[model samples]
Target: MQDQNSAVTLADAFNQATYIIGGHGSRKVKVLQEALEQVDGETFSDHYGNGSIIDEFQQEMAEVLGKEAAVFFPSGTMAQQIALRIWCDRADVKRVAYHPLAHLEIHEEDGLKELHHIESILLGEANRLITLEDVKSMKQEVACLLLELPQREIGGQLPAYEELESISAYCREHGIKLHLDGARLFEITPYYEKTPAEICRLFDSVYISFYKGIGGIAGAILAGDSDMMQESRVWKRRHGGDLIGLYPYILSSRYYYNERIGKMGRYYEQAKELASLFNACHGIRTIPERPVSNMFHVHFALAASEVEPLLVHMAQEYSTAITSYLNKTGGNSCSFEMSTGDRYDLVPQDKLRDALTWLDGEMKKKRF
Candidate 1:
């Protein structure tokens, strides 16, 4: 149990720590200044997501994702739901196939079903990546398939490149549309050794989140052929996603994408290095053994109660914040996810290894 006196916020823990599992550190003033500097004379957009930075950003994203057009949404939830709805409507089949843990199925609170009237058929086991065999096994008629690259819920697992191609081929042969839930698309390209466009080519529509790997203030892009995106714009307005002015989020997304997009390969390498360090420790291990992307899970042999205090203590003493808390998966094991980015980049490898060693020792001592 954590003492009231020792309580630390996740935000403060992030700021105090020289390293973190996800994202770079930013001061409020610095973030504000960066956003302001990125903007030119014109700041705001005209009515309903038009004529300014929003259109410019959307155009840039469309090019980046290799699509004829792109539409911006305030959230990925709105963007993705609309994308799936489009596919189902086109095929006249109200079902989509995706992993059981895909965001659309678990995280969206049934919005796809209740709001869009689309049914989801979950694919594959909870602990495994979706395979071509699993796709072949689904007997239901699905209008589209949604693939979440790097499968964030299960320690950022991803399908093999050849296997991904096979699954997409199967979808195409069957006349089913493919939509990619590429919220962290930028982070996964390093593993596949492919460009975002190359991977995106396999899908009918791709949705990218601005805030996740790109570190935007907040926004999402749904990109596809012009006809599909044109229809999406209407859905965006209907869903209340078309804002009067979205330049702040657009400008922030543009600035961060430019700054961080080039570094994702390095982040993927760092994740491998960090995972190796964790696996080398006696009492800790990284899930998937080798990281396929910029994220992985660190499992400790300690209970949740025991691990929480250690995290709090680490924050107070070593100025290292591993995570805010640990989740007990089952039995005596607890796991927390680590995502390498600029925060981890700021700290030396030797220093981070030392922190891992100390954490290992604490977990061992507590277990005995």
Candidate 2:
């Protein structure tokens, strides 16, 4: 157990440590400032979602996703909710379906239901990816079906491409709109050995986050057919997502997306490598065993309370922070998420090896 009187929390320790292995790196203000340092703000005029910077970024993302058009939103939540609502409105059915653990179902505080009055049909068990069978078995008619690639909550697991194709065909045959919650779409491409457009061609609509694997300041692109995107623009404005100037988010998104998008394969490989190291440690295992993307869940055989002190000690002593917190999964087990990024490349291999060795020895002492 951590000392009650200790001044440093696990998060503080992780943040203060010399080496941190997680997404991008410190999300300090300077990260955004540095990304904008090369830009001349005076040379570009800010316009409300209609001008060069925003319009070009939206067009670039639409081409990348193989959609006819794309609309930018301040957040993925807004973009996604609007996308689903648009589909539902088009189908004349106020119902949608998605995984039970989907961000819409779990994270959005029922905004889809309350704001749009759209009923959500959960398609599968919370612990697993929504299989094609799950979609085929749905008894209810839905306006749209939302599929998240590399399902984020479940350690970034993804369905096989064939299964995705089957699901897409089924939805199309039934006149059901298919929307992709592809916040991490770019991260999964290397795993599937496909391009962004190839994977996105499977869905009627797609939403990509500039902040997740792309390491942007914050923004999202919602792309689909020209008509749907025009409708979404109206919806985006209705949702107050259209600000006078989103250049900070837009420019930062473009800058970092270009910088890191090409490195997703490297991040995916690093995630698998890191997961293997965790699996090698006693009482620790990674979800999926092999990562399908640059993210995975780390499960500990000990309670979160027990794990926190150990992680704090590792960060303080080894100066290598794995994670800052753990979520209790059950009586004796806890878990935390690990997303590989630029920081993982910075960690000394020997230091990481030694830290894991120390962790393994400690876990053995605890018999966990």
Candidate 3:
């Protein structure tokens, strides 16, 4: 087995592979250049979030989300924090509920607690989706309930449509505002067989990321009723989220969102196909076994130390990179997340098949 430090070397080699089977594409300068290629600098302008470019995009997103209004934020962290604050203030409660692994709970370094002074009530176990039973059994009152569609941490799994509706109805009956942490909202539409607006209507407010599935530079849209939007505008300014000119992020968001929103179903199908290939291997399996969105987690019954060298060899010899790194998940097991996108379609089928065949044979050898 390779030393612990060898994972870094393997990752570096993986990045240099001719083909990578994840994400929209490489994050090179050309990505920005391509997004702005047709955008005319002179025609669009915004000052502190109040111009045609920003206004029109906000309106379009509001319509898409079935909300009365939408406000663009520099980051989903800021937007979601402010959203919970608004709900808490309205209900005169300082607590919000969400999955144990919601982005704000795990990734934000307690910004929601420190910046917004809002307490979080973790809803479900760390390893599974939050069920309607979890919401019904909340021991304390919370001003808002947040649900992340296709929970990212647990292999992009989603609750069934009926379960979601039941949760939404219960929240409404209890006067608890439901907000969607829909950073990858567009990516899950194919599985639910519902439009974005249909899903957004279940929640009181919805937040969508432009960078995640849309492949934008960076930005998010917070959509809700007119009253909530007006309040959010105030909070956005207070948080310094309103920039003098956000045309770069705005234009790229609009460009890529329009370009890729219709292709979510294609990405979804690609994800299932790829996950099946991974599952066919001797000791590898995807988290959900079947994807509910464009993304899923791949687990190997071998330690990171055992997998890194093999992945490096695959990249070097097959010119196809499956993943760059793995996270050790206790004794003799490791995992990594995969999200299908434009690059998945770009990989040569014959090369991908041969690479996986080699991987399966090697994994069997290691296990035995």
Candidate 4:
């Protein structure tokens, strides 16, 4: 019987939840919602099935990514798979080269194999990057190359720009097309000191995610030259990504990008500050000496049992949130991905240091 407006949310109980994955959605989403509610406003009028809005978005993204054209998809998985399939069709080859931890190689559930019938040649070690020299040693003529910007599973590490340029340049000389899985690209831009369009200029096809940085409900955009994307649209439908309603995605994306853009730099700053606070702690070390962006991983030792429950209990007590994934060491490591949320606004580096220190103390107290 209560009004819908009075509904409660998960945020009402937990105040300090550190959003390692899905942070707050963007700010620009509200404006779009407001516009949609207007009396004469046409929210899905033209763009529902076949519309110019998609074309407009594609063209703008192509220009921003410095490609000839672009195609929007309901998911990055479809965008990336179709992009590779297109390359295979164009090159008349079926093999791809990529880092071992690349999303397509590990996370896409073998879509390239099942859906596209393409194979992958893992380019490097589980813990390291795939370099130009790795490409030089390839045994087969791959149809394409896949590169993930700021490789996430390995902790958001990126190869040096010089190395990235060399790898792409080598692909060009060898008649191999390069495709970029630029899902977390905007976060990587500050490190490279380059624009998204500039980073994408070297590749034949680029896929950017709307959910990761832009905070959309869910969507992805694939950009390339006109002919390629014109072809990708057909593939998009064949692959079942042509959703009937895209208003929620577009609206949320538009809003989040505008609102959260200001906070990204602060995330990077606070990550560095937090890294400093964890200095010289026992059994604790950052994956990389320095966090490349707003995201980083903390590798620490604790009793296997203490790892998960301790985090959950502390989270509940402090009204905070965090996620920890187990490791080969039988210990636990946690990640901090500072995206969106006022939860972290009042949480200082010292507080995080205190938490880490508490975890260590708890482990010792239990004699584990």
Could you give candidate 2's per-residue lDDT for residues 1-368 as a string of tens digits? 34443567889999988999888877789979988899986747447678888889888999999999998899999999999988888889899999999999888999999999999999899999998889889899999999999898989999889999999999999898899999999999999999999998889999999888999888999999999999998898899988888888988999999899899999999999999999999999999799999999999999887778888888888888998888889999999999999999899999998888998888878875
Where's the lowest-lDDT run of ten residues in candidate 2? 1-10
**Which runs of model 1 end up more than 4 angstroms from their true locations?**
1-15, 18-21, 26-32, 43-46
For residue 252, give model 2's deviation from the true position in Å.
0.4
Tens digits of per-residue lDDT for model 1, 1-368: 23444567544665677556555765365774677784666555646877856777888998889998998889999999999998999889999989999998788899998999898898888888889988899899999989999899898988888998998999999998889999999999989999999999998899999777777778899999999999998999998888887776777788889999999999999889888988887668888789999898988876676667677666656666777657888777799888888887777666666676777777667764
The per-residue C-alpha lDDT of model 1 at residue 202 equals: 92
| TM-score on alpha carbons, each prediction | 0.93, 0.97, 0.97, 0.84
Q: Ten residues in a row with the worst lDDT in model 3?
A: 1-10
Candidate 2 error regions (>4 Å): 1-7
Error of 2 at 97 (Å): 0.1
Off by over 4 Å in 4: 1-22, 25-41, 45-49, 324-343, 346-350, 363-368
TM-score of 2: 0.97
Better of 1 and 2 by lDDT: 2
Error of 2 at 268 (Å): 0.6
The per-model lDDT (C-alpha) reads 0.83, 0.90, 0.92, 0.69
